[model samples]
Target chain A: MAELTTLREAIAGLVHDGDTVALEGFTHLIPTAAGHEIVRQGRRDLTLVRMTPDLVYDQLLGMGVARKLVFSWGGNPGVGSLHRFRDAVERGWPAPLEIEEHSHAGMANRYVAGASNLPFAVLRGYVGTDLASVTPTIRPITCPFTGEELMAVPALRPDVTVVHAQQADRAGNVALWGITGIQKEAVLAARRAIVTVEEVVDAFAPRPFQVVLPGIAIDAVAVVPRGAHPSYAHGYYDRDNAFYTAWDPISRDRDAYRAWMQRHVLDVDDFAGHLASLAAVA
Target chain B: MTAWDTDEVMTIVAARELRDGAVCFVGIGLPSEAANLARATHAPRCVLVYESGTIGAKPEVLPLSIGDGVLADHADAVVSVPEIFNYWLQAGRIDVGFLGAAQIDRHANINTTVVGSYAEPKVRLPGAGGAPEIAASAGEVVVVLRHTTRALVDRLDFVTSVGHGTGAGARDALGYPGRGPVAVITDLGVLRPDPATRELTLVAVHPGATADQARAATGWPLRVADDLAVTSSPTGEELAVLRDLRARTAASRGGPTRPVRPTGR
Candidate 1:
């Protein structure tokens, strides 16, 4: 039902140029390795999607991979602004970024609609707000049940959706716990879904509130340990706070960002190589 | 006893706004710190909900972000982002919405989207995540910000979250259910919306903070309440708990955690 492949193979074969890709992770279980792989392969003209679009998106944006960003919010987490994202939006240093903003509710409903094979999602959002002026997709619609008007946003069926989880069984059914986010909805909504996991086990032990993506739903599974490095994988490891703090400085300047990407992400053969480099440094 | 900074004072004032058993929709940074402090002290039963879908999270350490694994681990339940905003926030289950504003106008309209024009901004800020809905539907809103002349502006560059809009009936006419920004907590003083005008008026000044200083910091004509009371200094118990929380957070993160200070420039 699902093919077991390497991260590089998954990125190259499944992810293509000009495709709408969603790297869906709230703050936890961020698919940073897969994002790095996309950058390494040098995919361009891609519309990257996420709720927050944290450091991974920042990295991709800095590397000039994203042509557009469809997101609710983009930042450097507990720190401050995403400088590279700011540069692209403010000055168009690497490239000009076209933004389609939405509220978290609107974006989530978009994915839900996609997953449910619906044309659009309805919600009480963007009412009396300036967001409607900038985003054309957010439009008011009259309800059938009642005469009241509500907001509607089209379904977000991305070309590819990538996420990181704690474990996957050999059968390709992935299990992830703790702030699973909209990974399930994003994966089911995508034409292709790539899941990177910390480990592949014989069978999942079944934790409380675990989301198990059936093998048939997944296109590919890549066993990339510590896949969500700066972000955490719940039971596997704690979030690397030091790295998140360090990213602010590394990603602030154009030169520093490029050099860091060159050394860490682009220069590495794969995620393992990236890990080795970090280990070597430590 | 550890000496409290202005930020701590600001947090203490913000924490006092939360009522026991109230459902608070907490934004990250100062709001999170203040909400957590309230839960740890007076508002023990306060239900904390984060945008990351963690509901009733009780983190021993300050969360690095809303989606910090610790939040999920400590949460009573974790729902989807859509459910959080729609089912909880927009449905008006959240009694209090804690926010941090970059720029707040005289009418309490907040600007967290940009510093200049929408098309061409001098500084592009982190756009609204769930703040719009939270501000619209939460029973009340508490704004925690580092008070400065630049932050307290006459007009907002962009309205990321609508507080009172302009006057009393402004938010109601817009069809929002909740009472918009009830209080604005700053390092110098606390500003509450006038029932009639909906304008945020300086109602109380913190200890060692002068009313003139608070008035001087506001961009518009700051109205001092006729019956303005001095905000009581933070109790030693409150300070100790807050200090311990910060220490634990710093130890966990391998560095000291500090609240964000927004600069309009």
Candidate 2:
């Protein structure tokens, strides 16, 4: 059975320095509160992984917690570039960051391979593209039956995988809905998994199109309400479009980004405190 | 019929390029607008697929990102991300791959990754999501970008997506199943690949745009078709539907807050 614990305890016990951590979400249900707790713990040298490294990953990159990034795409979504990411890569401001990039297809199949306990996955991608030249992990393979060529990428098994979901029952079964990206595969592909949920209920009402992770599969479940703020939690709240728009300016400058993180992430004790501080300022 | 912005004219041109019942792999920004416009106006049966695993998504509002919930809300099916690429895209099920690029070269190669060297210096644009596969696997790829010398360059600083490679047969050598980029639509006009050279050539100019102006805007020594023609102006109904769509998109939650235009010029 999964242990029910606080966010800080969950991070402290499960995640460690130099672990390859994957926080999976499509464009919603981002485990931002978990990211904040990781920052608050001051964990360092992590290999951060995601399909699209949005604002949460940007915060991790800015805080000098990440040493490497294995991702397909990194951006501010509706906004422009991630300035902290740029600074790390372009100028090595916080630290010299290493990047191993792939296409969305490539990364997703890698996770699928890991979930299946396969050595690698095959797909017809990266052909005639520059990515193959840059990322050595992508290689060519031939079909034994037809002699056709395909691209192959190794499986991605992270040390820890964290995600945010809508509900978790008292039995520790987690339920997620709406735009479920690779959360399931990501969880199964990791050594340890943590799920932060909007609420802990007594029993789950099964619904169509909902993915339920069995209690045995998860290591820990933490109740962090509004955990996916900035990013939405599907039916619970609307995406903070105003904050996304506001981030472009705040994250554009180095000093501004550092100051904002200091106040919002580092100085705050927990997610609730972070929310309270935000409310007080607003 | 009515005064249309350059962006509107570009959208109409892009929409006309789509065939009815074509399965188009779409990206965000202008490609989404063009594909949605094609569905609303000319190509009503066009199937819109997003990389977020939403297939046949007919959103009432423009999706802010590929992963916006509105896409999944009305999608015919929402599969996992791997299945969308391997089974649908790489299997050659997509008839058209519509994309937007930050930088494009004479060979139609696109760069959405970086502006300078790989390790350092200059701007860091959004890296490729599904474009590399979309360009290589789709039966045909179409690009929409702003018309500027900087955008239409002689050589891209980095090639994020493969088009015709350097010339004809270049992409084939790499075992790409698709034919690569066939057309490029810009604010000024349309560019098609030359049959023999595979170099992008000016085929048609939008109204109020001149051949000389188009040539001057290209970074390379551009070649114009001997019988270049003027694009037919947007019809009144077309403009009305396109405008209405934009208005609705701006009003929709999780949609563009401002007027939709091409980014990454």
Candidate 3:
């Protein structure tokens, strides 16, 4: 397995053009910096999938890096700005995005099923509703054992999955101590996985049993402290409202957003410089 | 206090008696915040059911709405609205159905489907999602609404879900297994049913409210509970969190635009 040797080179190396990429984090618990880096670096036609996208999706969508997006829900908390998305829906953009609306369980279950290398997994979720409204790519067949009809959510084997972890070791094994059920499944379902950590540990054993993502599933680790800035790490930090508001996808002016991007992201290629610029602005 | 202050009181009044593990079929705004607070503090195991299929949602932040990823992303399991209603809720699982109202009557009846006549009337609401099924099948209903004479009318433009209509043991006679609409919680006070005629009776009042004030807000002969309790005001902590969530939610959609408030339908 090719290990991530350096932070700057790792992200650039792992992520490729025209690949289906699924990102980790949501809303305020965003993978802000790395996501901005990916977007500003101009990764194009890269199908981006987030459980429920917000600013990251908007920034990328607005910038035209993402060609297609598959998600359950889009738009920010209250004043969700899926306007670029709206315009894409109303007046087709780069490549009119395809929206797949369903519950989070249904969205992740497909990945879970894929990760386990199972033919299909039976779930009693979304049995009766408009969730069946979104025409799925796969069709269902009757279960012989119970005679109950089972839905077949297609396998989600993304080309690459980028996740933000709370901590990681030198050998690439990761540990995420926050709300995590989707992460385990996501890391496995993808062909390649990149784990960004808040700190790097050297053969350091985790004191808490719950803190781990065994070495086998992980391939590359990038140690970037305060990695989950906008995204809180369980009880570590409260949501940075100033940071969130600064990147307010719903209300931010185009020019201001462009400037924010230029100064914080485009102007710098590395995390340190990005942090420095962010500090300079702050 | 001001009218919005009254609304906040009404919101808390409904949340007062929440028990653990209740499958609260929630909508957005006040209901969502109340549901989350009840879960976070009072009822740890409170299974917050949403229309978007999230059940037992433990969101890090107060979800902006039912469809907020925080709802399902952190939920125990997500079920379809039909299954949420048909199997879990209507199949007799939900403990208490917490709901807000645009209008109420002395009979504890609610109107959310339409404002005027069914076919051609005044306003059209977001439409009946799972409210009909929930009202019909939940263990019991606990309604939260601001008490205004116009809101607490003698008659409804439409019967969204039969809470307690004009008769005694009517819902029981109709074969509703669950005890329906035990109380109507409002900014003014809490109202229960009179055992004899199933008419609504004032059961509790807020800190500053009086029985006469609650009576004035109703259009019919409002019955009185034997010993009514006064609902405490939102504490500083409660206000801080609720207000923070409210402010965030309000400012979320590009800072507040004029809200469409007519839902007597």
Candidate 4:
């Protein structure tokens, strides 16, 4: 239960370049601030996954920090386009980039099934139509015992999973309090897990069930209060819908996006300056 | 049935269930054609929601995948992936989840990941995307696959998504309740859950299907509904409309995928 001297030191130790990482926050979930820091550090060849909501995926794509993306549906309405991924796919832009499309619950189930190590778990889903060809990860194979056909879903395991939590203790057990999309699975499936907390509580042992992610699965924890700025926490700051509408227009045009990023994200060494710059734009 | 056979009956079946104003989450291939047929005939207002984020898609033909251009070519509105899931799907506004299957067990669980063992897979199909979410959140899910032994499995290689969640009782235990499956419309017939077990039970027999044939094709002990009904053979009226729709669709750039079901039976 040792507290790190600095946030950058904690993050640098947990991450290595070209690693496959899964971020905890959605497009609107500012839990991404930690990951944005990683990107700013010049990580490359990252295969990022969007479990469900993926407004931020475009940002990753636009910045080129994200080379390979695994997701069902990842896009923004007004500004960003599926054109990048599509173009990459046409030319295999990010080599070995795989697109697996399915419903939200379906994506979660596959991950859960992988985490549980269950050979197969049955659910009455996709009964009447053709959502079967989203990805080639799972295929129908004849059951040797019964000779019946079964849909074989693949297992997903990321190299590292970085999640932002509401609170945590020095021990690294953090609280996510629902609205956690595949966070548990990310922790369960990844080789290493990092939990970033808004605040570190000293009296964490007072409550038990409040702990969402256990310390056993966590390798490191970073405490950054109100770190989920720009991206809001659930019911905290409302989603920066302004960001959503603005991201595409800025990123869609390469020159404009690069200029905006240089002005907003890059060239600022400190978080305070970054925050102030973002505020100026808003 | 071969393309000649499936062409007649498949079109007839697709036209009936789909109607105007229905919001259908379309699968890529055959379903794209079926829904398009419905749109051409009587369901002009049926909105097609592709998993790639295009909603209210009226593709000219079937799409190869969700990323197919036609899905977005004739769209009403397009939103972000997160919004589509957080707002529309997980929020449960979609009426139908049109899907295909590689393997379907007794409970209708699907596998879209691998064909062999995970440690070293023999075949890696596409991984599960949002299929589980669709099954869990759609008003109801519709499975469209060719009736055969390979697809109608006793067990799946990998359970892609839980359609009913370990049969009937488990759904309630799981807490997040969904409408689950309404029907699994296949080239052979239609399937529904058993009254007592909620396991997939043969509810309708197609014109060419027999109890013995269905049993022979199943990987499990095929159970027929107590009041199983025979699907009507394609009549001239139905065939004409179906053929016309298929011609227009196939001729159009956006028709469905190859109307071919591999004979794994």
Q: Highest TM-score among the candidates is held by which one?
A: 1
Q: In model 4, which runs have C-alpha deviations exceeding 4 angstroms?
A: A1-282, B1-4, B235-238, B248-265
Candidate 4 per-residue C-alpha lDDT over A68-155 given as tens digits, one digit per residue, 9 for 90 to 100: 6766544432222343343344444334354555545445555666567765433333433244544555455566797654455556
- Which docking band does candidate 2 fall into? medium
List clashing residue pairs in candidate 1: none
> In candidate 3, what are the lDDT values of residues A54-143, reduced to their tens digit?
666666776667777776555443333344554444445545665554444445666777688875655433332323434464345578
- Model 1 residue B262 lDDT score: 37
> What's the true lDDT of residue A226 in model 4?
56
lDDT (Cα, 0-100) at A237 in candidate 1: 87
Cα lDDT, model 4, residue A94: 34
Give the fraction of true interface contacts kept by model 3.
0.03
| Chain A fold similarity by TM-score, each prediction | 0.98, 0.98, 0.86, 0.80
Cα shift from native, residue A248, model 3 (Å): 3.0
Full ranking by DockQ = 1, 2, 3, 4
- DockQ of every model listed? 0.71, 0.65, 0.10, 0.07
Every model's Cα RMSD, please?
A: 1.8, 1.9, 9.2, 14.1
- Candidate 1 residue-wise lDDT, A80-146, digit = tens: 8998989988999798999888878789999999999999998865777778777899999999898
Give the lowest summed-lDDT range of ten residues in model 2 chain B.
B256-265
User: Candidate 1 residues B1-265, lDDT tens each?
Assistant: 5577788889998999999999999988889899999999999999999988889999999887889988887689998777787788888799989998889998888777888888888998888887878888889999899888889998888777789987889988777888889999999989999989998888999988988999888888898899998999899999989999999999988877786743210
Model 1 alpha-carbon drift over 4 Å, by segment: B1-3, B261-265
| Per-residue C-alpha lDDT of model 4 across residues B72-96, encoded as one tens digit per residue | 5557775544446656776777887
Residue A53 in candidate 1, Cα distance off native in Å: 0.7
Models 1 onward score TM values of 0.97, 0.96, 0.63, 0.52
